[model samples]
Target: MDDFYSKQSPFNPDVKSFRFYKNGNLKIELKTKEDAEKVARLLLP
Candidate 1:
């Protein structure tokens, strides 16, 4: 298998950029280019 272990620097947070969500039951929107997909997959949903 290809080694796909990610590096810390490769997933650095965007200080000026961030995802936003109102409440737990509300809608959530993420920065388009911030690799939000990876983060989203980590959610319980």
Candidate 2:
């Protein structure tokens, strides 16, 4: 699942950078909240 995100997003060190839960929820830990939101929008349905 993490590997899928790494391939989709530009962010590196995917495991440390992003977290995806089983309920289709996304938690992104990064300096740029805006960037995280962008990725989240793309990811979420």
Candidate 3:
């Protein structure tokens, strides 16, 4: 399963900085820890 495909919650970006909240528009339930890491990597990449 090396070819993994992951997607982001659409409202993830609109989230306030330094504040954590669940995105209301995604089709999947993205955990806070997972979302934070994903968003961090996306921005830093």
Candidate 4:
């Protein structure tokens, strides 16, 4: 998942940072909530 995010990050300038929780959840921080939502849509099916 980290590698996937790294590869995809270049196409998403709005992404500020991303982390994977110990519980297996992904947390992505973006410039704005809308950007976060957009990233979520792209990352998810």
On a 0 to 100 scale, what is the lDDT of residue 30 in model 1?
48
* Candidate 1 local lDDT, 1-45, one digit each (tens): 323332122234432233323332332334464546766678848
Q: Which stretches of model 3 miss by more than 4 angstroms?
A: 1-31
Error of 3 at 24 (Å): 24
Global lDDT of model 1: 0.40
Residue 2's lDDT in candidate 1: 25
Please list the C-alpha lDDT of all candidates, in the order they appear: 0.40, 0.56, 0.48, 0.65
The best candidate in terms of TM-score: 4
Backbone clash total for model 4 is: 0
Reference-based TM-score of each model: 0.28, 0.34, 0.31, 0.48
lDDT of 3 by residue, 1-45 (tens): 222244433565544333223443333344577676776798795
Clashing pairs in 1: none
Per-prediction CA RMSD (Å): 14.3, 7.5, 12.7, 6.6
Tell me how many clashing residue pairs each candidate has. Answer: 0, 0, 0, 0
Q: Candidate 2 at residue 31, lDDT?
A: 60
TM-score of 3: 0.31
User: So what's the TM-score on candidate 2?
Assistant: 0.34
